[model samples]
Target: MTSSARPRRRRRDRDRGTYSVETAVLAPVMISLLLLMVAFGRVVDAEGAVDAAARAAARAASLERDATSAESEAQSAAVRSLETEGVTCRTSSVVIDTGGYALDVGVDATVTATISCATPLSDIGLPGLPGSKTLTASWTSPIDTYRGRQ
Candidate 1:
């Protein structure tokens, strides 16, 4: 019994450091995976924010009666929406299609708004990840057919 126990103890002692070595090798991989998930989550969040901003801008513009004011309102609405969502864009742009304003009052018209934003991800410093991602979203809202338009 003593002889058998002696060999078992020696084997256990030899394998003691294996866990440390495995952990040493796998720790970075686990950390990298975690960072990758974070980066992905940020991108998804940015996309959702952009989508909402576009929707808000289009809705705001559709409420306006003139092309000039519609564009102005759309731009402000887009900016406000992004800010409200806590998304910090490196560069942001809003494009408003006010062609619907030119249509007759009784016609079915729609206002389109496109929101573009550059989201920064280089701060994460994850390998193989892009330094920045550009996200764009467009939304169209129908104007009230019976409403007056200039």
Candidate 2:
């Protein structure tokens, strides 16, 4: 404690390597958290896109006058919606259910569109995760009771 002598170092001052040690301990955890967030975000985004596609396809199908046209329109709508989001589908499929066409006026019928998409995320290289994830979405639109049946 003499004026000429160096002051006694506090315990905190003695630890010059603490930052490196803390960084070494925290780097992997931080990196892992970041990667998990990215993957989760991708999945959420894909889900939203697929849901939108399903809704669009169902609406398009409901607007069609015939089963064939409905099917085609549904497929096109689903594909276009997904593509607009820049989500690549390894193998995408659209199925339209036309059972409601048989119902008569005053009865409700539904146009249903189911879209299944296989998106690859192998590039992320996360262990225990599948190379590809299948995302499926379905939507139903009610056909107008007065609409003509075909």
Kindly list the per-residue Cα lDDT of model 2 for residues 14-99, writing each as its tens digit.
Answer: 78799999999999888878877878888889999999999999999898878888888888999899999889988988889978
Give all TM-scores, in the order shown: 0.95, 0.85
Stretches of candidate 1 exceeding 4 Å from the true structure: none
Model 1 whole-model lDDT (C-alpha atoms): 0.95
Candidate 1: worst-modelled 10 consecutive residues by lDDT? 98-107
Query: What tens digits encode model 1's per-residue C-alpha lDDT throughout 1-150?
Result: 999999999999999989999999999999999999999999999999999999999999999989999999999999999999999899989999999888887999999999999999999999889889999999999999999998
What C-alpha RMSD separates each model from the true structure? Answer: 1.1, 2.5
Among residues 3 or more apart in sequence or in different chains, the pairs in candidate 2 whose N, CA or C atoms overlap within 3 Å are: none
